[model samples]
Target: MDLLRRRAEAVPRGVATAAPIFADRADNAELHDVEGRRFVDFAGGIAVLNVGHRHPRVIAAVADQMARFTHTAFQVVAYEPYVALAERLNGLAPFSGPAKTIFLTTGAEAVENAVKVARAATGRSAVIAFTGGFHGRTAMTSALTGKVYPYKAAFGPMPPEIYHVPFPAPALGVTVEDSLRALAFLFAADVPANRVAAIIIEPVQGEGGFHVAPFALLRELRALCDRHGILLIADEVQSGFARTGRMFGIEHSGVEPDLVTVAKSLAGGFPLSGLIGRAEIMDRVEPGGLGGTYGGSPIACAAALAVLDVIEEEGLIARADAIGERLSARIADYAASNAMAPIANLRGLGAMVGFDILDAAREAPDGLRARQVCARALNEGLILLNCGVQGETIRILVPLTASDAIIDEGLDMLAAALAE
Candidate 1:
């Protein structure tokens, strides 16, 4: 209550909080509020805590780096951790041939830099994104994002030359064919293929919903980019780092992205984002063209290296699959139950699961009920979140390191919330 009061006075209203509780501490998959109440964390800090809150390995890495040095501003005095981390990411790049990675401070920077790289490589100024896809919060990314209400509302005069086509979501009445046709139309109508720099997409839409991109759509996009000399960028900011069962979500479709924007869980909980691209395209930018003063902090790089180690050593990729199965099964049972509110459209890849709350008639999405479920889940000591075009999706992002018992406990709370 005191913290809420202080926050009301100090913080801007534009920054909304999903829950009013203040975090006192957090463990692998649980958080304790300042009031000393415990809650199961199913949100995973908006897909940024796949390794969970304060993993010992990440903490130790950060502490060790702190003991050595915090920041030298990689641009001023290139550090080893940054280079080593970039090397690891490059080796893990989803595409074939030599790859290169440049670290940045946030997902937006990685995405924005990716556009810059694409334009530099292709000598084109226009970019294409999909409806229901979210790239970032920056001006350029906001223009790239398809959603309107909150992300773009009142933020008038978005940057030009960013086009959006329909994303294939059957529930939304947009089919793969519809999306492809729209793309073709976009090429002919708004911008020509030759003038387009790149087409950026999330292999699995995050803020739009946990809808997995159809492999057919990806294949078509790849072919289109190939024929037109446009780059294909995979924005893995929310779907990367083992949250999608694979190391990178785009790997699921066997469609290699020319450039991948990665953030969120890249450094466990640290603020570290990176853009990995084919070596030739990456080198298109001159020496002084890329980099930020705090682009690759030594502490974040150390944490990211440790995060990579944790993902490999802990078998988190496989763990993500198991967690997804458990969540899907439970949600499937909920859909069958008349005791719960109408729920439909359970979808996701790996553990990045989402289901929509629907009207009692099952004819339409029920954003109100979805919000109520989240509210009830919070009251029941479970931290949950909603997404999708209509805000009717309940996305489950519990940590991969979470124990089965913790996962089940969170699900039980979720069930109770749905019943209410």
Candidate 2:
């Protein structure tokens, strides 16, 4: 706690609320601290290390790029890696028409740029986002984010005209029709639909919980957006890259979004994000309307290219489905057994899985108990993350590359923690 406490004082207080573990090194799906304590990494750097930690291919790519050049500021002198990476992303995205890709440094940048592009194309000022969706921390993204406690606590006076509606969860008593009703209500009560430029969502909410948006709901949203001329933006920062079985989370419904924002595991660990959209729509932003000094760093682009190679060669998308099936079955077994606290409303797609902790009476959500279980799991050498509107659900985002032994060990720790 000494180093962490010091960090709290030196760094902005808002940036330090997660688990206090200070990692020294990591590999595959295991992390070691300064004191040499080993823990199975179920968090995967908040789902950024899909290729696992310190992947050999990613390491070689970065090392090889570093030997040649680290920075040239894509705006000044263009690089081949950036162009090639964008080409790959454009082809891989779910869009049927010709697509264009723009690289950025983080998910928030991609999101902000996507919005800018949407506004530019539609000439509208308002945007709609769903509650429980986690966008990012930038001023505009903070405004776009649906959760209130941590993301919007002190940050207020957020960008205006960003309306929020309920995200559907049938297990939680909200249906697709309910979501549609909310959207209709928003337009009638809050803002007019014609003024809305875009509606962005996480196909599987990240910080909100691993709730998969229903297929019917996504299709309806797409239809609504199409009819109303509102662009559909899918924020795939946490659910992208084989995390949800499909390369993109939106693929679960077989619907195509006008724009898709991707980051997190896109570069396997490097800081890189991209906005992929229809070529005609993406071209709305003029030459200088989109871009940043470090938007497409050469090193990050090289690492992303390597990540694509690894995903293809390793068949990670298929592996994600298998992993999720196994994990869901194990969780279902634990839920059936009364050995640990009851897991209610267990749901997810692919490797993104979550279950809510039930109350002592085994009825309602027990948020405090969920936090305790996460803490105990961490102490017992397993890493887990808690989510949900009230923080009552536990979500697992283990690397697609993690082995069966590691996954089982992490689950055992979780079971023990719940029992305690």
Candidate 3:
């Protein structure tokens, strides 16, 4: 703790703060703090380690690649792993038709490149995004993000021609029709539909309280985009890779996006992300228009390939559904017994579960209490995270690799925190 406070905590206020558990080592679904305390990691590095921390396969693959080569700058001297990884992602994307993929180092990079591809393909400038959507923190993604605090605060003068409309949140009383109406209004009032290059959304919003975009709305967006030549981009940075019981979150709805941005859990713990889309759309960008020095580092690619193998061999998609049901049931049970601050608006798909924190005094949504619950859970040996625009919602993002015992243990800590 002292080392962290001195070295890390003092570094930057811009860095997000969490409980003072300095992870010394991690394995499977458990993390050992620097103080040697064991904690069940429900947070999963904010949903980055879906295969769990330091899985032997990922570790071994990364190690093997490191021994052969680390960075050759795929553009300068191409590598087989990069090509192989792209091939795998191209097939894994939600589209049954032919797709292409471009790798990058972070979720933000994937989002930025996706927009670039959209603009290049459509030859348009305006991009439509939904309220409570979180794409990334790049200049363009920050513009795409709807929530103002933290993600957008102090990051002034965002990109131009990006527009935001209300996304449906039934729990908050915003219906799918309301959201579509707002989009129509946006086209009339701001950027017209033809002028819009892309309409991006998170199928199940991550920072925006895990609200699943209705299938009806997604179908509507696809129709609208098709009518106006606007591309649909799914920002699956936080919800992709079996987190939602499918390879991609957009799979929840049968609607296909023109381009999809994926990251977080793509490479287990490695820094890797990608923009996947129709082959023609992806080919619009010039050879040098996309890619970075470490865009598809060989080691990261190897690790990502290993992650895919793990997901398939372990049948994590099925596990995600079962875990989500169990977690949702437990949360519902807790809410039923505790009438003082009943959990309202329980929502999510697969293992990505979330519920509201009602006010202790008035039984209304309480953001502070949710933060308190997270803090208490951390102290009681469970890693947790809070989301939602108002931060009044607690989300459970435990790894699909987690065992039933670990899930139960984490839920026990949550129940104890609520009881307190």
Whole-model lDDT values for every prediction: 0.95, 0.91, 0.90
Q: Which residue runs of candidate 3 sit more than 4 Å off their true CA positions?
A: 8-10, 339-341, 361-363
Q: What is the lDDT of candidate 1?
A: 0.95
- What count of clashes does model 1 give? 0
Residues 23-69 of candidate 2 have per-residue lDDT tens digits of 89999999999878999988898999989998999999999999999
Candidate 1, residue 381: lDDT: 98
> Which residue pairs overlap in candidate 3's backbone?
none
Clashes of 3: 0
lDDT of 1 by residue, 285-309 (tens): 9988999988988999999999999
lDDT of 2: 0.91
Q: What is the TM-score of candidate 2? A: 0.98
